[model samples]
Target: DTAVSQTPKYLVTQMGNDKSIKCEQNLGHDTMYWYKQDSKKFLKIMFSYNNKELIINETVPNRFSPKSPDKAHLNLHINSLELGDSAVYFCASSQLPKRLLAGSYNEQFFGPGTRLTVL
Candidate 1:
């Protein structure tokens, strides 16, 4: 079973079109997150959801929305997708902070990746 899995591992989209990426984790983790890894190899966190609650990233654009149906799944929706949004999105699973005793600093288990290409 995949600890974390994101669908459509490769997404080729045109500018201004809307798209979505689904993510699911089988690890029974409480916290799920979205991280964007750009061409520069820098990883920037986007959103986090737990127990069907949304945790927004202050730097994330309003065009990006995250939905969580349960603790096992978190999906990302992008509206009016732009060229700037072209990057690899990684879904990750981790333990929630409050419930963690130690050694839990978002030590995430990442999915293979969803590569988004905007043209």
Candidate 2:
């Protein structure tokens, strides 16, 4: 079974339209994240939720919103989608990172992603 999954693997819409993507994880993790990959394949984190609390990336525009109805699920909504918003949106999940003397790292498992194309 897939640890993480996303709906509507593909999304095509015109500019100015709104869209939403849903995600779920069965890994029983407490932290979930949303990431966007541009045409150039540069991945950047858009939002994160820990135990259902929002932590928006400061650089992300207000047009992007992430809502977590529960710890196991996270949904992303985009208002007034633009051509620039065309990209693959990935949902990921990970447990809280633990501090260690060497450092701390949280391994994130990513979903198949939803490809959004704005005409």
Which candidate leads the pack in lDDT? 2
Clash pairs, model 1 backbone: none
Error of 1 at 112 (Å): 0.7
lDDT of 2 by residue, 17-58 (tens): 999999999999988999999989999999989889876565
After best superposition, candidate 2 residue 87: deviation in angstroms?
A: 0.4
TM-score of each: 0.91, 0.92
Regions of model 1 farther than 4 Å from truth: 97-105
